[model samples]
Target: MKKPAKIWLWVALVLCVCTTGLNLSEGRWLSVAIAIVSIIGLCVLLFGQRKAGYIVMCVCAVGSFVVGVTQNMGELGAALAIVMSLIGSALVPVITGLFIKSQWKELK
Candidate 1:
């Protein structure tokens, strides 16, 4: 992975850890679990298992999004949560993926 890709992965890892901590403090078990999964996925990416990490991250992102939507269904607050999770959790892997693709192209 290129420097930029590594940086993104690091950022994602940090965000996942922070989110997990926050969820734990607030007693949100499900959210914490999702963050933990995301952290593991980010670690896998950092360790050079790019495809596996990407898959893991994608699954976690979608899982979180679904949970957020279902849990908050029929409420404006829930809608907000869904949007935030989509942006926060989903954006990380996407940005990392973009950097990875750019690095691969550069290599070629």
Candidate 2:
């Protein structure tokens, strides 16, 4: 993968962690803002590969939705969020691998 793409992916991950941490602290608005920005950052990285981008976007979106539901919402929301986050987290590595492979393909 390109250096910039790797960097951006890490940044997204950091932001994801930050948002989740903030959520636990009840900083809902801040968490949401960070999540939104990270999602966009992920999009910028998407230019490298549409399929990778779409996968990452879906994962991040689902993760965000789960987080939103879990906090200060209700049991239903929490359950949904938990499920989505788990699924998203599981898919993240696969999408990242695809991104790296796509980058390598371009390099050839």
Candidate 3:
């Protein structure tokens, strides 16, 4: 993968870890599990399994969003969850596209 994509993936991994830690502190086991899964998906991306990683990340992102929306948290918490999930979800596709473009250029 390209430098930018690698960096982005690392950032995503860090974000997942941090989110997992926060969820752990809050005793939110399900959120922690989701974050852990996301971290694993990011590791897969770093290891060059682009399609699988992207799919895992996308699924986790949606799961996170749904959990956030239904968790009975206050408005602010729900909004934050929604925003984070959206950002994570969006990043997967952008990073995947970047990797694909780089691969295409190399193939040419």
Per-residue CA lDDT of model 1 for 1-108, tens digit only, reads 777777777877887788789879988788789878878877877886557777788889888888667666566477687786677667887787787875543331
TM-score of each: 0.81, 0.36, 0.72
Off by over 4 Å in 1: 74-79, 103-108
Q: After superposition, how far is residue 84 of candidate 3 from its true place, in Å?
A: 6.7
Report the poorest 10 consecutive residues by lDDT, candidate 2: 47-56
Q: Tens digit of lDDT per residue, candidate 2, span 1-108?
A: 577667757765665666557665775664466466545646555544444554446555655655555653474466676665565444544455555665645532
**What digit string (tens of lDDT, one per residue) describes model 3 on residues 1-108?**
667767777776776687788889999898789878877877876776456766677788788777766674465576675676566446655565566565533421
Cα RMSD for candidates in order: 3.0, 9.2, 3.9
Rank by lDDT, highest first.
Answer: 1, 3, 2
Q: After superposition, how far is residue 33 of candidate 3 from its true place, in Å?
A: 0.8
Give the lDDT of residue 7 in candidate 2: 73
Candidate 1, 75: how far from true, in Å? 5.5
lDDT of candidate 3 at residue 83, scale 0 to 100: 76
